[model samples]
Target: MEVVIGLLAVLVLFFAAGYFIRKNIYREVDRLEARKIEIMNRSLADEMARVKELKMTGQAEELFEKWRQEWDEIITSQLPEVEELLFDAEDHADKYRFKKSKEVLKHIERMLDAAEQNIEQIIEEIYELVTSEERNSSEIEEVREKFKKAKKTLLAHSHTFGNAHAKLETALYEVYEALKLFESETESGNYLAAREILTKQTAVLEQLCAQIEVIPALLSDCQTVIPNQLSEIKDGYEEMASQGYFLGHIQIQSETERISGSLSLFQEKISLLETEGIHESLQEIHESIETMYDLLEKEVHAHHYVLAETLKTESALQELHAEKLISKEETDAVKLSYHLSEEETSRLRHIDKQISSLQKRYTHIQDKMANEKIAYSLLKDELIELEKQMSDVKAEHAEYREMLHALRKEELTAREQLSEARTLLSEAARLVSKSNIPGLPAVYTELLSDAKRSVSQVSEKLNELPLDMVAVNVLLEDAVSASAKVREQTEDMIEQVYYVEKIIQYGNRFRSRDENLSRELSEAEKLFRHYEYESSLKKAATAIETVEPGSFEKIGSLVEEDLEELKNK
Candidate 1:
């Protein structure tokens, strides 16, 4: 009886377990299908938004068709197959085949997963297809408005517009035609093609508008402003010429004729409403007028400059001429000693020639003023030009005279330098003699020889005919340099010899304390005997320092005192 009751309890537990298992399996299937339906709904909404935004319904239709195929497969194949399998699994579970039911549920889950993946991928592909086709509606309208503005400018300035702007007219007509074509294309959903056409047309229309707007200004300038400027330039030329400006270099007649020709051509072009290169020609004409005015103003300035400079030049030339008449003899003798350079010689000849020519011109002008009633207006420039030449000649003469003065000054300087150099040479030799001769380097002898040779060379330069004072000065510098070297070497040798003697004398004190000190002192003495005062001083000082540590400095101070006393003596 206990065994029977236990079996009944086991059957009730098994039935409850089966019922719970079947319910969980159905719930899992429902959950997977709900997830797929949710994804499909969200993806469809996304596709719809993409289609509306991009106006790319072609790809949206393809995606929707593929989705429909997938969905139909899911409903017909996956759903029904899974449902039939679930029934078989249910039958197996009813017969206690829970394993088969689980396997069937797994199969349903896999199909649902694959279907969800395919739907997600299809959604992405449709999204990719339509993503970049973002449409802007006003692109063509913007270009059309630009064309209209350009056309408005053309119509408003139709009368003043250059008749030869047929290209502009053709462009306008083309714009109009293209606008119609754009409208048609736009209504037909060809926005991209219409946008491209509108972009190119807008650029063309903008360029045409720019050209059209400048037409009236160009016409008015060429017709009135530049012509008035030409008149002003002509009057300026005549006015300046009346003021005695030498307009000889300025081809007034030819330029006036050229201006007339340009004006006539411009009038003909204006009559024809010519446009090609018209603005360039207008600017060229304007520049020509300005250039003419510039040239006329320059002439006016030159005329005034000549008038003012003429009086200055005449007065200066007269003063210089008088001075030259007086100083001629004085300068001639001064000039005889001068060694002029090539440039100076040529300048002198030029000055003389210019002075003679100017005087001749002055005399001729004075004669013309006396007899032919020559206007001072004309003679002013010519006479001023001659006077200018004379003034330059006088200035050139002054430069040449200054050059002569420089040479004489150089000669005097050379003499003074030579004397100074001789004194240095004597002092250098005396100083060397006072030093220990055997202790001197051979280089000192060579330096003394160089000094003597330099002094002799400078003295010879002083005796030369042209007296190349510059050469004498150069030799004096060399002598001073050489003498200075001899002086330095001799002085340095004397100082070292004295220092060596003091060090050696001081080193003797330490020689009794150390055998090496005695040996070092002997070696220093041998070097001193050989006239190597610098090395001897070093060795002796080192030897002394080895014994007394600061003995060399004390010795140097004592030797300096002794040398100072000798100098006082």
Candidate 2:
């Protein structure tokens, strides 16, 4: 009984699956039918009616027929084929051949797609034709209005257009011819051809209008503006030439003539309506004219500069010459007393030669100015160079003059230093002699003699002819150092002698009681007599400090005070 129930259940499931498969297949069939109906109901007829409004000849008529034939084929043949496929698909599903039903359904879908594509292509072709016709109609009217306006402008101001007038009129006629061609094509029911013709004519009209617009300005510049500028340049050139300006190198006349010839050729080009690069040519010509003007103006400015600077440069040159003469005089006078180096004398002569050459060049420049041969610009450059040279010469002269002046000042300074050194030496000798310290040691005597000899050498250098101050200063420096040393040693020796005597006298009391102290004082007295005051003082101070430490410090300060007093005396 359980096995019977399971078998019954299996039958139920099979029936149910078959029922679902049939339902799905029928649904697909219904969808295919709907798609077929959609293809049939397409407004291909309505879209074709739009094309009827256009001229139905040439490509338009042929394409319309083609679209109609294609739509008819889809409706009659392709859609029926899809319907048959859909019926086959339903029959396969009923027989429980689902795989076959699916295959038939796929075939039906492919046919519907092909029919739909054909319908879309036909509608698109019709739309393109209709849109082209409409656009061609509206564009032709706009271009025609613009063409007439351009013609009117060309006619009214034909003179301003100069040579471009006849050429522009011919171009307008060509645009009109194209318009006629468009009309001819339109009348023959070649709407697309007419559209192409109208499009080309519209472009031609636009270019013609642009040419007409810019031609007048280009002509004005070529004919009037640049020519006037060239005339001004010519007039200025002639005026400057008459006024004795050296303007031959500028070649203003030749350049202006060349530009004029170019302008004539460009005017011819404008007449032929070949104005592509003529505007740029005119602009270049204008710039060339301006450059010529600048050249002429430069010459005038240079002439003024030469005239004004001639006087100033002459004055400056004269002043420089006078300074050179003064330098020569001062150099001569100073060299008589103080020796000047050969390099110094040679530099002075060189400066004189430079000034003389400058004078000669200035004379030549003046002659050129009088003859009016060289350009003033060249003369101005020469003058600027001359002024620079003059400034250099002045600086050289001033430096040499200062050198000459320094010679006398240096002589006086050397003499003053010599006098100070002599006084210091005399004072040192006087101090030593008045000290009454038996006598100086051999080294002190030798240094004092050396100091005197140095002073004598400095004086001898000052007395020589063409006095070499360099040697004199060297001798003077030696004298100053030697004299200062003698003075310092003299003061120190005298103070030590006085302090040694005082310390010995102060130690006499201890000497009678201490045999060692008495014996050391005796040695110090013998050293003092031998003029060995430094050693004598050391021996006495050491003996005294053994009995009394730090006793010499107070004695040293007292010795300093006594030395200052002796020097003041």
Candidate 3:
């Protein structure tokens, strides 16, 4: 019983010590939790003060909001959790405090990192908004400049920026409506309709930007700066659109909603801007528009001058080409004429001279025929007396022929001589027939035929008549006289035939001349119509000179003078 009392007393003492140790550990945990809460509250207060300061100083509101939200998350949501962890660590101080502290510190670090990220996001957003706003304003100025340059007068109703702005606002409204429709379509699970609406919105926005470009103040407002800025915006928008950022994707939709809200706020602010300053702003826009107009007008005038110069040069070149063609035509005509053989040309000229001589002879003969007064009775008496003398001579020749026949056996040599004389007459007649006589009054062929007939008749008459040597000699003399008469007639016929041939050849020559002159004249006229006046005149002169030298000199001189005048003009 004494051992049991001793063991029981020892157990009681151990229980008391354990109870105090548990109580002390709970108290220490509670204290640490309170201290952690105090630290968290202090950090929250500091963060809140920073946000308030930023708001009061008109710092970026987005930045201030982001910082405030971070402070709330730390103080309201994470601070209590951190306090619980600290209390748990105190209860296990020998083993848990070090590891638990590390965990708590890690949580705190994460919160701080989140806060920094929020601040950074806010700053980036502010920077982007400010840069975009500046670029948009510059584009507006460029549009104003383009408007001024495109029209003649800023005061003109068609040239006014007010009209352009109205059109731009209408387009913007259309885009807004399209975007709203796209949202509605996406919400209703109509992806195709949503895509179509988005496409339409994009097109409308593009049109708005294009129209803004026409307004000089918006497109090139600052001649040196704004175009580049507008280019960047256009490029950025294109890039974003290409990446499907403007469609109703989750992230893009959220961003677009935020931008739309911001745009609404901006519109409200613009509406509240003083109405009294609007007239001055419009006046400035008008001035920019006028400057743009002047530049465009100058460009137009310069273009007109350049076009006129080009036309003048073309006209001159055409004239020169026409002149060259005319010159070529003239050369061809001359070459054609040169192709005529010299022998043929000379023959034609000789024929012409012969015809002139024959014409003179014919005129002489005609004049003689007209002037002569002849007595036909006296010519008949002379013919009768000559016939009686011829009859007596014939009787004497017949007696001589009979005497020669009686002495034929001894007079063979005399008969042969007589035959030889007869043969000489026949040869003379043939020579006369072959002779080329000019200016004969009868046809050569008819005269030769008549002479042959006379010879045949005389040969028959001689055969019938008997004659001695003396009578035969007399007959031969008469035959010689008759042959001379036939020869004279043949000569006259040859002259007449020659005259006819000469006249025909002369006529042919003149016809050729007329044809050549006519052809040359036709060619000259063609050249003139083609505006080759100088070359045409040269050909005309050459043609006239060929027919009648110095005849076309006056016309050629006039044409040359006119050409000089044209040059001066």
lDDT of 3 by residue, 1-569 (tens): 99999999999997776566556655655655555555454543443443343223223344456656765676676666666565555545444344554454456446545644654564554444344334433443444344344222323433334434444455455555665665565444344445455555555455445444445442223232333433443454456445433221223234334433433443333333212343344445345444433433343443344334434433443443353345345434433422323542343344334334433533443343344332222223333443344344335434433432344432344445445545654654554445432222334445545545555544443444232334444555555555566655543333333332332332344446598876776776666455444455566556666776664444445445543453344
Q: What's the CA RMSD for each of the models?
A: 15.5, 7.8, 43.1
What TM-score would each prediction reach against the true structure?
Answer: 0.44, 0.72, 0.19
Candidate No. with top lDDT: 2
Ranking by lDDT: 2, 1, 3
Candidate 1, superposed: residue stretches over 4 Å from native? 1-338, 371-375, 433-439
Give the backbone clash total of model 3.
43
- The parts of candidate 3 lying over 4 Å away from their true place are 1-93, 97-109, 129-139, 143-569
lDDT of 2: 0.86
Of candidate 3, the 10-residue stretch with the lowest lDDT total is 244-253
Candidate 1 per-residue lDDT, tens place, 89-140, comes to 5676666777887787788678767877876776766555443233325455
lDDT of 3: 0.46
Model 2 Cα RMSD, 1 decimal = 7.8
Error of 2 at 61 (Å): 7.2
The per-model lDDT (C-alpha) reads 0.68, 0.86, 0.46
Candidate 2 global TM-score: 0.72
Candidate 1 residue 143 C-alpha distance from true site, Å: 50
